[model samples]
Target: MADFTTVVSDAHFLEAPRWHEGRIWFSDFYGLGVSSANEDGSDLRVEAEVPGQPSGLGWLPDGRLLVVSMTDRRVLRREPDGTLVTHGDLSKHAAGPINDMSVDARGRAYVGNFGFDLMGGAPIEPTSLHRVDPDGTVTEVADGLWFPNGSAITPDGVLLVGETFGNRISAFDLTDDGRLTNHRVWASFGPLPTDRSVEVVLPALAVAPDGACLDAEGGFWIADATGSRLLRVVEGGTITDEIETGTPVYACALGGADGRTLYACAAPDFHAEPRKAATEARLLATRVAVPAA
Candidate 1:
């Protein structure tokens, strides 16, 4: 059995967890906010309210926080005075609601979208990843992703994006100006479903990679939404280790005082109405042997 402990509870579908400075920062998917807390979930504080619902969270080198406002297809920045302002408008570049994002050390953010009305039971469709500059210019840098959900940047500046519906993790080389190129399969867990309907694709995923974080061991710690586990994968599509969370884990982050703490965002289901009506989602944590990146 995998070690698991609840850091907090009664959340409205938590996702997009990040370990920043000395706290765990995360987005409450249906709660419409972003929050942070100490290592053990103490001193929990709401840092920003994203009316459209928050998905991913990242920080610029200058310490400003960048958060994804999912439904609106926009990125918001939290100013030092706590004001939330538009960082970029991605509606023009995205066909559906934007999901996970990875902001580089230079503050450039790479975001993904659903490419279809996921909650409305629309047919599953392919999507692209967009890069939002620090100054709020938007550009479609990579296309043909299958519901890109989570992402992380390697020490050498490579990007690993988890494609939930594709049953694979895609990798890219980050250009000096914040664009992605040289796309390749970083990992694959199963075959892509033949049926594109949401009914079939929803249950067909075997690995359903969602959110991810990097470790000092040069591996990825991924949340498997359908597999109910946190997977650690190395280069060449190899799963090095895994921790069964016993619940649907939608996102994860590796951070703690010593950088060995693995944080997971879990809930009973991903449906917005059910999660929004009841606060059953939680933030969970476990200790790992590898140091974080």
Candidate 2:
């Protein structure tokens, strides 16, 4: 286990961490906003407020902030003047609440959804991944995903997505127009789960990948929601390193002045009711060998 330090304490379930513009930016589900802080957790600033609950955080090519409003299934864009406006609406396409997202340099956002009423104890179901263009057009680029969650785009144009219930990291090639092609599994922890019930599937999963980020050495640092740890996995499902979080780590990002800091969003559990009523969630950090990609 690495020596972990608290970056931000008393958060209401932090998720979707990103290193951008010399700061660590993230979303707080029950906090109803997005925030950024300095590398050592100083100079904390609330960037945007989304009453629907913010999950994902990204930036457009023009530097406008893009946020995922989970409950309403909409993407909100923060203009230069700091006002939020609907950038894209996924209400019609998404079956459940939309969650994490990854934005490419071209401002194309690849967003994912829960696919089922996770908090309501509904059975897990496959869902689609939507691509939001620069003009805010929502298109279902891929489907049959078991709880698509965190995502990242490599420098070589490969889109890697973590399927929380699928026990695998799926890859896709992005076309010039931002469309996904050549879908394949980048890493598989185990065979595709056969059970749909959360009770049955979660205990059987080899790795429950939740939030992830890419590193310069082609490694993927993933927060294993079920394992209460963060794993450094390479191609073909090989876990090269692991960090025992001692708490449920839902998301992670690699960032710092030198890009060697590994930041994790952690809490006791991911239950909505409990998380919304308390402030036990925290952003923890540790030093790592590799830098961000």
Candidate 3:
């Protein structure tokens, strides 16, 4: 087991962690904002406040910040002067609140969303993934995903998306025009569950793939949302390493001065009511062998 330390506490459910510009940037869902902190838990700052709730964080090539506004299904871009403006509207494509996102080198963002009322206890349904161009055009790139959540784009253009309820991570080949093709299973924990109820699916899941970050060796460090651990997974469903988080981890990111530090977003549970009612979530950090890709 690796020793974990709290980097940021009293957060209202943190998610979508990313290592950028020597800081750990993440989203606080119930806090309704995006924040960043120094790796050693110093210099905490609130970068942006999203009334609709922010879940994902990424940057454009030119250094502007892009955030996923969950409730309104919009991607808001933070101007250089610190103003937030709607970059893209995904309301027509996303079936539920938009979740995590991955911005490619060309500034194309692949966004995911919940397929149903997850916190309201509705049956789980497959959702679609959309691509938002830098010019703010929204297009559905793929559909039929089981609760599409966190995503990461490889240096070579392969996009990996975590299917939290499907027990698998799906991959797609990114075309020059920002469309996703060659859809296949990147990693599978078990057969897809036949039932859709969260209660039935939770206990049957071997690994609930959530937020993930790629390593230099092509390994993916995934937050096993249902298992309360961080798994270093290579292609073909093999787990090369694992870290016990003690709390349910929703996201993980690789970063530090040397890129060996792994950060995790954790909380007691993902229930909206409880998370919104109190601040029990934390950003935990631990050293890892592999660095960020």
Candidate 4:
């Protein structure tokens, strides 16, 4: 447990860490790229350069990679030779910038967005969720959502999405033909506040951050972007535990040999301009008991 260390730091913006092919693969948001590294933070490698800002990341059944190109509202596939090609164009389907995503065993990816101009300093809009099929078809899964950030699919293929602006997690049914149905609320906040408030006023926690993953025990690991903590939630939407970090926790995933190590990609100044920020962005790793199944 004590061996955990910082893998990468001073990064511009980082997201989406996944354990694939014996390594940790993720996307660099403000860095405008994708990369991989060993569990021990060695053998670091840059896998691709996505020009439009890559967000959520997933793997196809055939060893290819899928990334959400946030700026342009598109999904891309990384070929074996590290070339990125379009998997689907979501310009008309997405109401806002797509954030994090999760791919099921069948290669269907569920994506969500900001729902409005968040950084523009305007009011928040209703963000929605979309489901992308393997055939490159995009469909609206749910609408009128608060800001959908990180998302995950259960081993049974049930979809769970983090509603950042709503401060709750939503569960959906994934049909056999790749349709999302039976939308329901899975979890929400209670009476306690961790550490996300600012200026003596608690910021409304509607799941405003990004990146999420499922644990082997059927629980979900969520990054409290403003809270500076990682929360473990069960299927019934109970908070099992919460672990604190130095910076605002933006994204998270399970890596390492036993899949028991949780890697959190955090940044001290996430929305701050590069030169004006105090702490540089970083990737932090910690150990956990349960593995991801």
Comparing 3 and 4 by lDDT, which wins?
3
Report model 2's TM-score to 2 decimal places: 0.99
Candidate 2 on 95-195: residue-level lDDT in tens?
Answer: 89999999999899999999999999999999999999889999999999989998999999999999999999999999998889999999999877787
Q: Which ranges of candidate 3 are over 4 A from the true structure?
A: none
Q: Candidate 1 lDDT, tens digit per residue, 1-293?
A: 57788998999899999888899999998889899999999999999998999998888889999999989899999899999999999978899999999898888999999999999989888989998898999999998888998999898989999999999999999989887889999898888777889788868787898999999989998998888899999888899898988888999999999999999999999998999899999999999999898
Error of 1 at 265 (Å): 0.6
Full-model lDDT for every candidate: 0.90, 0.94, 0.93, 0.79
The 10-residue segment of model 2 with minimum total lDDT is 188-197
TM-score of each: 0.98, 0.99, 0.99, 0.91
Model 3 TM-score (2 dp): 0.99
Cα lDDT tens digits, model 3, 20-103, are 999999999999999998988799999999999998889999999999999999999999899999999998889999999999
Greater TM-score among 3 and 4 belongs to 3
- Model 1 lDDT at residue 64: 92
Could you give candidate 4's per-residue lDDT for residues 90-166 as a string of tens digits?
88988788878888888988889877665565556666788888889998878867678888888787888877766
Give the per-residue Cα lDDT of candidate 3 at 278.
96
Question: Can you list the residue pairs that collide in candidate 3?
Answer: none
